[model samples]
Target: MCACKAASVTIVDGLKAAETKEKCPLCREARVYEGALHMEELNILLSRRCPEYWGERLQHERIERIRQAKEHWDSVCRAFMGV
Candidate 1:
């Protein structure tokens, strides 16, 4: 896998990519298809499907910072969970 960040891909671009096969880190596949899960949507979907764990209060400077942190976390989880 390429040690590349998809930051420049833009949030909207990622949203658009959601309708297709997601950019994979393992295969590095840029294949396009339907139903790929972007971070925001994935968070929403996961929030609905998974258990809620809002145990502690977050004191981030901005929501963007928190979101960015979760995005990194999500990638790591995906890798480990083999999602």
Candidate 2:
């Protein structure tokens, strides 16, 4: 079995402990969350052997951007019509 022998690092932002983020054990990659809480750490490590990890992440980011843009446009229209 494959495993990352390196220790996990935690990054704290200013005095906000809640904003702390953890880097991946393998490549030191980090995301918005503190750790790989969205998925199993074992699965995340295994996914490094495939390309589906980045593909899924990119698709998620694209969908998030579209959702945010839609919300922004809706708010703008609401303000423009004075309603």
Top candidate by lDDT: 2
Which 10 successive residues of model 1 have the least lDDT summed?
52-61
Q: Per-residue lDDT tens digits of candidate 2, residues 1-83? A: 01111222212111123334544455766543344344356456756766687677657656755766687789999999999
- Once model 2 is optimally superposed onto the true structure by TM-score, how far is the C-alpha of residue 29 displaced, in angstroms? 18
Candidate 1 accuracy as TM-score: 0.30
Per residue, candidate 1 scores C-alpha lDDT tens digits across 1-83 of 01113323433244443433455556666753234344447556655665443211112224545676689889999999999
Candidate 2 Cα deviation (angstroms), residue 25: 19
Q: Candidate 1: lDDT over CA atoms?
A: 0.46
TM-score of 2: 0.41
Runs of candidate 2 with Cα error greater than 4 angstroms are: 1-50
